[model samples]
Target: MNFFSYLASYFDFDLKILPYCIGLSLDILILYPLLTYFKWHLLSRLGVTLKDKEVIFSSRKNNFNLAYFVNKYGDRNLRIADGLSRKLLHIFSGIWHLVFLNLVIQDTRIAWQAAFVKSLLIIALCSLSYSSNKVFGLAGIMYGATSRIRDGLDGRKNFFIAQLAFLNLYVLVFIEYIARKNISNEDNLIFFSFFIFLPLIIGDALGEIIGTIWGKQKIRVWGVGQINRKSVLGTVSVFLGSLLPLLLVVSLNNLPAEWWLLCLSVAATTSTIELIAPRSTDNFFIPVGNALVCLIFAVYVIHL
Candidate 1:
C-alpha cells in the first residue's frame, strides 16, 4: 500500500477525499503567511492586523522590513478589526471543513476532479463575496459614520447589497443541488438554518452585542483604514457567543459529536468573514459563502 492506501487503512475512509483535506489544509496553512508577509502598512490599513511600534529606523529598507511582520503578529485589540479578522479566519476554516468533510466522511467515488471543480466554485463564490463585502460594507460603515442619512437610504442600500449577495448564493446552491440530483427540503432546512440564518442573525448579534459589552479597550481610531477597532475581549466574546446557537442546533438535530467540529468551523468562519468582509454586507456574503460550503458537503454525501 502506498500513501493513499496507507492512510485509507488508518481511517478506513476513501482516497478521493484526501485531495479535499490536502487542499483545505493547504489553504489554511497559507492564510497566515499570505496576510502576514505583505506590506505591514497595507495590512494595517485593511484592519487585518494591528500596529504598535513604528520603526524610526535610519534605513528605509530596515524600517519597512521591521514593520511588516509586526503588523501581522501584533496584539489585536480593536473590536472592528478583531471582528473582521475573525470573520475571514472563520470563512477559511469553513472551507477547510468542506475539504475535510468531502474527503473523509463522504464517499470516495466522488472523483477528485469533481471535488476540485466544486472547491474552485466555492472559492470563487467566496472570493466574490469577500471582495464585494469589503468594498460595499466599508462604504456603508464609512457612510454611516460620516454621511447624513435621515431617510436611512444608506441603510437601505446596505440591505439591498447584502440581500442581492445572499440571493445569488442560494441561486448557486439550487443550481448545484439540482445538478447533483440531491436536492431535498430536508437538506434545505438544515442548510438554510445552519448556514444561512444562523450566520447572519446569530453571528452578527454575537459580534456586535457581546463585543460592545465586553470589549475592553476602545482603541482610538488613529486614522481611517487602520485595524484600530479590534479588541481581544471583543473577539473572545464574539467567538464564544456565536457558538451558542450552533451548539443548540447540533443537539436538536442529533448530529454526531464530530458535527460539532463542523459547527465550530462555521462559527469561526462566519465571525471572521463578518469582520473582514465589511459591515452589513456579510449579511449576504456570509450566507453565500456558507451555501457554497454546503455544496461541497453535498458533493461528498452524494458520492458516499
Candidate 2:
C-alpha cells in the first residue's frame, strides 16, 4: 500500500475515542513544559542553586545534572527529591487512566488505542531528549525534571528506560483484554482495567515515597541503579497500599467471596515483585505479575 493509505489503515480507531485521545495528547503537550519549568523552581527551593539550574537547563548532555544535585545536596536529599518527583509523576499517570475510564471511553478496545497513542507521544518525546538539536527545548526540560539518579549519570538513558517500562504496562493490559473472553461486558472491562492498574499506581508509588522518607531498616535487593536497597517499611507500605484499594474494588463491585483471596494474593504478589525486580523494571514486572496471579485466580480458583 502507499504511505498515506498505510497510515489510514494502521490507525483504524473508533471515532468515539478519537477526540478524547487527541484532547488528552494536546493537554499533555501544553501543560508538561509548564509543569517542568515550575518543578525546577520547586527543586531550587529545596536545595538546587542558580548554577545548578543553569547546568540542568543549558546542557545538551545528560550526565552532569545528577552530579550537580549530588554535589549540592548530598545523596540522600537527592534520593528524596527524585523519589518525590518520580512518584508524583506516577500518580499523575494514574489520574490519566482514571480520566480515560470515567470521562473518555469504557470499551477496552478504545482504551488500548488511546493508550497506544499516548505511549507513542511519550516515546517520541523521550527519543527527542537524546537529540543534540536545539529546537526540542521541552525534551531537555523533561529530562531535567523527571530523570532518576539511581539509573546512573546518563539521565536521558534512565528516563527512556522508565518510559519503556510504561509502554510494557500498556501492552500487558492490551494482552489481558484480548486473552480473557469473559470480560465482554462493559463494566467487566472497566473493572478489569482498574483492578490490574490500581495496585501498580497506588501501591508502588506509596511504597517508594513512604519508604524513602521513613524507612530505617534496609534490606539489599537487585536493580540497575546505584542503590539496590529496599526498606522493610516500604515493603509493608506496598502491601497495605495494594490491599486497601482492592478491598474497595471488591466492596464496590460485589465480587464473589473468593475474590478476597484474589485481592490478598495480588497484593502479596506485587509487593514481592517490587522487592525483587530490578530497580526501575518493577514498573513492568509488578503489573505483569499482578495480572498473572489474577488470571490464575480467575481461571482456576474464582472462575471470573
Candidate 3:
C-alpha cells in the first residue's frame, strides 16, 4: 500500500474523507511559507515573533532557525510570524469547518460541494465585517488569506472587527452543522443555508447603510459612559434587517404563523445580542443565540 493506504490502515475511519483532509493539508502546508516568507512583518503587528531577526541565528548549536518552527499564541516571540501563524490558524479553522460541515450534511441530501461553497461564503461575509475597520483583516487570517484587521488577530482587544473574524463564522457553521442533525423539525438543511446567514447579511448591511445615512441619536452598548456607542436608527435598522432572513424562511419554508412570530423573535433577539454582546464574543453568540431561540420556538411552542 502507498501513502494513503498506509495511513488509512493506521487510522480506522472512512477512507473517502481522507482525500478531503489530505487536499486541505497540502494546500495549507504549501501556501503557508509562500505567503509568510514575503510578509514576515505581520509578526510584529500580531505581537508575535519578529521576522527580521536573522533566520540563520539560533541557539540550537547554530544549526536550526527556531523562529520558523516555533509556535505559541499572543504577544511573544515564541511563535512564527503572523503569516504562518495566520495560515496555521486558517488550516485549523478550515479543518474544523470541514469536520463540522460534514457532520452537518450527515444523513442529509445536500451536496458537499454546495455546502462547502456556502460555508466559505459565510466566512467571506465575516471577512467584510471584520474589515469594517481600516487596514482590514480576517478571521484566523481569513483561513490564512488576508492581512490584519486593525490591530491584528487578537480578538479580545479588537472586538469590533473580531466579530468579522472566522471564529464567529465558525460558531455559526458548527451550530448549523449540529442543528441539522438534531433539530426535530424542518431538516431540509435550509435553516443553516438561509435563516442563519441571510439575517447577518441583510441585517448587518442594512444597519451599516442606514446608520451611515440617517443615524443621529447615539445608544450606549456597555452602559453609561461607554466608548462604543451606536445610533438609534442604526440599531433599529439591524432589528428590521434581521427580520428579512426569517421572512425568507417564512416565505420559502411556508412556515406557520407561529414561525413568523419566532422569526420576529430571531430578529429582535439578534439585534439585542448585537447591542449587549460582550465585546469579543458577539459573533458566536448572536448567530447561535438567534438559532437557539428559533429552535426552541419551533420545537416547543410551534410544535413544528
Candidate 4:
C-alpha cells in the first residue's frame, strides 16, 4: 500500500487522472462498435455482401474498396469479436471503478472527490448512451434512413453541430475532472492546460471534420465513396489527435522523451485498433486498451 501511495504521488498525487483517462477511452471504445454496426447494417441494406473466412472478410462488390479493406486486413467477423471483447471490458471496468469509488467515498470524507467521482460516473453513463445512439443514427443515415433528407449544407451543418456539442460536453466534463483534482497550484498544471486541453480540443475536432470531408472509403455496397464513414485520412488523424494529450503529460512532468513516446505509441495503437475493430464491440475494447496504458503509466513511468 505504501508503494502504491508513493507511486500515486509520483503520478502527481492525483488518483483521478488515470481513471479519467480510462473513462474517456471507454467512450471511444463504445463509439467504435456502435458506428461499425451502423456501417455494416447500412451496407447490407444497400445489398453489400459480407462473407467471412477463417480470418478474412470479402465483399462481393468487385470495384468496391473490398480490395483496400482487405489490404487493410479484412476480417469482419474477427473484427466483430474484437469489438465485443472491448465493449464488455469497458462495461466491466466502469462497474469496477464505480464500486471502487463507492469504497473510497465510504473510507474518506473528501467532499470534492466524492462529488466529482459521482458526477463522473453519471456523465460517463450519459456519454455512453448518447454516443451509442449517435452511432446508430449515423448508420441509419448511411442506410438511407429518411432518404429524402438532402445531403446539403444544412444537413452537414446539423451533423457537425451535434458532433461538436457532444465533444464539447466531453471536454467540459474533463475540465470538471481537472477542477476536482485541484492541481492548479502545481507547476505542472500549466503544462497540462496547454498540452492536454488544447490538443484534445484540436485533435477530436479535426478528426471529425476530416472524416466528414475527404473520407473516401468506397462503401462496399454502393461501390462508391457515397457514405461519409471513416476514411484512411480520418484514421491517420489520430496521430495528430493523440499527440496533444501525450505532449501535455510530457510537458508537465519533465519525464523522459521515451515516456511520451510510449504514451503516443499506446494512443496510436489503440486508435488504429479502434479504426479496424468491429463496431459491434469497439465500445468495449478501446477503453480497455487506453485504461491499461494509463494504469501502466501510473504504475511505471509517471508515478514516483
Look at candidate 4 and tell me the lDDT of residue 268: 75
User: Least lDDT summed over 10 consecutive residues: which range in candidate 1?
Assistant: 144-153
Model 3, which residues run further than 4 Å from truth?
Answer: 1-189, 223-227
Q: Rate the local accuracy (lDDT) of all candidates.
A: 0.44, 0.68, 0.48, 0.39
| Candidate 3 per-residue C-alpha lDDT over 101-153 given as tens digits, one digit per residue, 9 for 90 to 100 | 44544422233433334445544544454433312133232322333221223
Q: Stretches of candidate 4 above 4 Å error?
A: 1-205, 219-228, 280-284, 298-304
The C-alpha local distance difference test score for the whole of candidate 3 amounts to 0.48
Alpha-carbon lDDT of model 1: 0.44
RMSD of 4: 14.9
Ranking by TM-score: 2, 3, 1, 4
- Candidate 2 has its poorest 10 consecutive residues by lDDT at 181-190
lDDT (Cα, tens digit) per residue for candidate 1, span 238-278: 56665787788678878656556656766677766666666
Q: Which residue ranges in model 2 land beyond 4 Å of their true spot?
A: 1-17, 56-68, 131-136, 169-189
Question: Over the stretch 1-304, how does candidate 2's per-residue lDDT look in tens digits?
Answer: 3444533443577677777678657635644565465557666777777766555544336446455556767766666766676677677767676666555675555666777777777888767656542323766555655665544554456567766787674446544644455433333434555567788889988998888777863798865655567899999999999999989988988888887887889899889988888777877888788777766666677655
How much does candidate 3 score in TM-score?
0.47
RMSD of each: 16.2, 4.8, 13.2, 14.9
